[model samples]
Target: MSIRAAYIEKMKLQLDELNTTMDELQSKAGTTKIELQEKYLKEMASLREQSQGALDRLDELKTSGEDSWKSMVMETEKVRDAFVKSFHYFKSQL
Candidate 1:
């Protein structure tokens, strides 16, 4: 695969794994106290939005032509990095 294709595949896989981890975290939150649960749910919603934003960026990169892929890659990385950093922070609280 070309560099663009390889990058897209890697991002897609990583995002899929992140989604799964989110689901597991949500499930585990069920046992938390009511007050903490509310906070956890709100954070999960924000994380989901960030995850969606990353997916949107990845889609934009995927649809871009070879010429535009260079630029799209940077935007994609920013979105993905933001989502990942947020996820790790949230996970650390758990």
Candidate 2:
């Protein structure tokens, strides 16, 4: 499958794992002491970091694709101009 599809699948899996972890954490929070609660918060922060990293990567990839498309359009315009100029020159020679 395409790279995009694969990336989406991976993100879905990560989301599922994060949800499960959060649920388990909430259940365990009932019995957790103050220190353990603090630790759980820290762990939750870490999980958030992971999700943020994935989102950042996705944004980067999207930006990269946009840049590539812009470059292609610029190059295509240049080629089209050159072709038009060449055609005009040939017509003028007739």
Candidate 3:
């Protein structure tokens, strides 16, 4: 596969993983106390927003030309990393 193709595939996998994590978190939140559940839901909403940002970056990367692909990749990676960090921190709180 071309570099761009491989990068896109990798991002798709990351998104799939994020979805799974979100689902698991949602399931846990359903069983928590109402007060904590409220917090969890709010954080989940933020996570979803971050996830959407990553998806948007991926879409942008898809249309970027070879000359600009590397920089786009870097930007997308930053989004992915931030999302991953937030996910881990949220998980730790549970």
Q: What is the C-alpha RMSD of each candidate to the true structure, in Å?
A: 0.7, 23.2, 0.9
Give the higher-TM-score candidate: 1 or 2.
1
Over 4 Å off in model 3, which ranges? Answer: none
Better of 1 and 2 by lDDT: 1
The candidate scoring highest on TM-score is 1
* lDDT per residue (tens digit) for residues 1-94 in model 1: 8877888899999999999999999999999999999999999999999999999999888899888889889888988999999999999999
Question: What lDDT score belongs to each candidate, Candidate 1 first?
Answer: 0.94, 0.53, 0.90
Q: Name every residue pair that clashes in candidate 2.
A: none
| Model 1 lDDT-worst window of ten | 1-10
Better of 1 and 3 by TM-score: 1
Worst 10 residues of 2 by lDDT: 85-94
- Candidate 1 vs 3: which has more lDDT: 1
Which digits, one per residue and each the tens of the lDDT, describe model 2 over residues 1-94? 8665575456556555655655665576668789877766665565555555544544444455644745543443444344335434433432
- Evaluated at residue 77, the lDDT of candidate 2 is 42
Error of 1 at 55 (Å): 0.4
lDDT of 2 at 23: 61
Give one digit per residue, the lDDT tens place, for model 3 in 35-84: 99999999999999998998999899999999999989999999999998
Clash count per candidate: 0, 0, 0
